[model samples]
Target: MATDVRVHLVDDNTPFRDSTAWLLETAGFEVHAYPSGPAFLAEWPSRRRGDGAECVVSDIRMPEMSGLQLQDTLRRQGCNVPLVFVTAHGDVPLAVEAMRKGASNFLEKPFSDDALLDSIRNAVAGARARGDGAVDSEVLAKLSPRERQVLDLVVASKPNKVIADILGISIKTVELHRANMMAKLGVRSLPELMKVALGHG
Candidate 1:
């Protein structure tokens, strides 16, 4: 019943998506459904918020891209949104692959609504814990003087150009430092990085 819990539902089956979305919504979750992995990816960037999605429920097999592919794509793009795989009876192996790639849980087809809701709750809890731990890692604590300066500028809501000018460095150099900071902190977006720097996550 948490208002902060938003779930993204990705599956190629229109009927499945609609039914699942309805169930989640009835259970008080904010749900968004996508017909395919590609469609989800297309909207993911613009849908991102400072806190990221609470959970992603996706099918393992689909047109365009499999659920594993979608998970990998999200990771590569620096989106650490918690993923949950929904698979058919015969897709357990694929679900395992999804788990190895950072999925929080896998719900087999024909699962009850209660089972699905419980899995999602667990995934959301895990995501919150991981996110908080990441924000406290030594990598974030051990920023270099320049990286700290760049991060401070970033948290100040300054553009790269402004940061470069203020720090008397080239814009490229500023960008490099910012990238390094992002990598060290395991954050993928400017807002996430800023949240870390501001100690709000």
Candidate 2:
């Protein structure tokens, strides 16, 4: 239940941070809002460790100590609090790298309320099941041969048109294959797909 989750919300933008905190709190999550990554890190050790699921939801871009850098710092300190990055469309590649480094999930900016809630829930659950950003062989085996082919090209960063041309298929067919591949792999983003393909941490 939402009430069983605790979210540490970090973003440089005060309005966005407060609004997101309010949204999460409204959804029944216990939220602690931070204006910067440093602020969160400074209080991380002192923060209450609740009995239920706990995670950090942070914006990828910040003027002082970006989210990725914060994530790295946490990792170096052996902190495994699950991290869910919030990123703009242009910062997706950075978010992908965060996944490879063991972030639990990331939401694109302008994401829906349910999208954020679902991401936080899934991040906590997935972390408990297999640690963050993990893709196992069993999950990989779910893809069909065609889906696997699409997965490979997609992980290679090929656009739909290029993938279609390379695979001798129509663009729509490539899109179908790509969609199916991601579904079968249980990955929502290209960076997640690449994390699976590249065998990241």
Candidate 3:
């Protein structure tokens, strides 16, 4: 966990917001609480400072503006802050949508303080990794065009035989290209390769 992490907690419920903020502060984090999405956006410039906040914990359901809507708005505005959704048990579909839209994680309500903290820690690590400049265009350009295609397929979770079929190459050739791309990108894991291909972390 990052000792200097700053978190923004957005929820209409005052008690939940306050208690969660207090808990995070006690855990050595700097926390800001907002009553609504608009309120947070209104004060965002001031809240987003030099180092940037590590993560945002927001409720999935709210009046006027839903958490998913807020996530979309942030993406439209090019804000790359990792978002963690706090939702009710029945909101799993919404949580899944949020994840597909790049949310770091989702916590069903009635969750423990430890669970929230662990999720926030993971979000912070993801944000740091994304901003590390480990997957720049220069690094990507090192691969040949065929290698890039194979890499893209690999990052898309395609199997070696599938990639070979798609690219009209042999399975052994696909494996060789995959290895070459991984070596050139200095990525050792499928997730890391996906992050590089997706321009995330």
Candidate 4:
């Protein structure tokens, strides 16, 4: 089906923005490329509601507002468009912070177009499945920090013992968290748990 999957792309580099937009469009996405985060914010409705924006692909370092700042602003404004951060100067700490803040994905610059497309696809699918982020928040709020950690490891296909070793907890504790996560997410099977862990409703 031809869905209205619009991607809001922001980057200070004009050439890169244009090229990325072209790539996204060629891959069957509708793209609106902006010169900076401020430019996007200027055009985006202040009272934005619902899940209209399919996703965002933005450069992490810009003069007007950094991508991290943009993500924060979007959250504050309740614009729950899924975010993908792309930066030339990406580091592990930066990527980790972005994900910790609920960014859909972070890609280093010079990434393959295929990878970028895959992220866009995943982000859009997750947005549709997530439906405005309220349900996701409600579901996640049910988990403790340790349970959330166990859920992540479970989604990575780790066995309970390996998850215990990684989290420095006992195997019984790992099992408990995994079971709690599954029950909270209302899924009885591992694949269903994985789907919930990935933010699919």
Candidate 5:
């Protein structure tokens, strides 16, 4: 769906990287495949020049300079390029850490093609909405008190039922408040909402 979008695919495994690149290219994305994080990082500055929807999809574990390190390096340099990590089941803790550090998303190994594509699209969109600015305080002010409460819980990764119980409201009411909060924040999906909640968009 995202025609001509640029995607940087980073992985140590030759086969996986090649296959993923092929898949993304077939889906109309312009992909640059790299064998390691450092390899990708070395070429990132020049590639970031043009204005286009772009994101990095990197394997979390690698022999030299792990994905987390790469993310840290980028953040330290004030680069806000959205990142979507490809991780193994055992690397979930690392993935969660990456999320806390502002990664757009993470996909476990053996993920479906559609899932990866969706994550990349969402990451790029979220980054574009953010655009080196924090979420506007005036937009956040549009939320009602109840909606704000729902938003906080949602950002904490709470489920609707749990949020309802915590707020002394019904599940339906929780959903309603959540919907209103998302609408007020101008977000259409949980990932988008999360980006907003984190004050990035």
Candidate 6:
């Protein structure tokens, strides 16, 4: 019902992208369509509002960057744009993982137009509740690139050893960066940390 919200749609399939954009437009929502993840990312910096009150609808599988990776990149860049992933039926696990990683929602392929609209409505509402993605972007902008990278891994709820292994850093180095990020973000505990981190995307 929120007609003013902008929906950014990205899909490798030209027909799917065009059709979905048309469907969303017909529903009284404004939409911007992109052919691929990199293409969208290239434009987002100039297009996003300072508050980032936008939602992205992307296919789960694309040529260069998957929908999941797009979500991660947004988080890393501090955009925190709400995301609704489109997935094949068999990619339900990927959808769930996207949700676990803070995607707004997911729609199965060949979904009813109503289903996608409903998901967009929910995403827009969530963005309103989250204060329009402004705080996250500002807070993350204060961190260095390395800190943001560490925070990205940290947001996955990974442990120190696991994070270090994944990033190819020593455990002590990971711990140091973790401590630095928490202090930089003014969070005193893990629960608080997760609250501030996951509260964004």
Each model's TM-score?
Answer: 0.65, 0.66, 0.67, 0.69, 0.72, 0.64
Write model 6 residue lDDT over 31-60, tens digit each, in one string.
899999999999987778655457899999
lDDT of 5 by residue, 1-201 (tens): 378579999999999999999999998998999999888888888887445389889999999989999999989998888888999999977876787577777788999999898888767765665564456768878998878667755664557865666667799999889888888788899988987765655
Candidate 1 lDDT trough over 10 residues, lowest sum? 126-135
* Per-residue lDDT of candidate 1, residues 96-191 (tens digit): 556545576677788889878877776665456456574465665778888977774565345787567666789999999988888888799986
Candidates 3 and 5 compared by TM-score, better number: 5
Higher-ranked by lDDT: 4 or 6: 6
Q: Order the candidates by TM-score, highest first — what do you get?
A: 5, 4, 3, 2, 1, 6
* Residue 94 Cα positional deviation in candidate 3, in Å, after optimal superposition: 0.6
For residues 17-66, what per-residue lDDT tens digits would candidate 4 score against the true structure?
89888888888887788998888998777423355447888888888888
The local distance difference test score of each candidate is 0.77, 0.78, 0.80, 0.75, 0.81, 0.78
- Cα lDDT, model 1, residue 126: 48
TM-score of 5: 0.72
The Cα error of candidate 4 at residue 181, in Å, is: 6.5
Top of the candidates by TM-score: 5
Give the TM-score comparing model 3 with the true structure, all chains together: 0.67
For the record, the alpha-carbon RMSD of candidate 1 to the native fold, in angstroms, is: 13.8
Expressed as tens digits, the lDDT of each residue in 1-201 for candidate 2 is 679788999999989998899999999998999999889988888884733378899999999999999999988987787788999999977876776576766778999998788778766654544443355768768888778667655643457875676566899999888888888877789877766665552
Off by over 4 Å in 6: 132-201
Off by over 4 Å in 5: 50-52, 132-137, 142-201
Clashing residue pairs in candidate 4 are none
Query: What's the CA error at residue 174 for candidate 4, in Å?
Result: 11
Candidate 4 TM-score, C-alpha based: 0.69
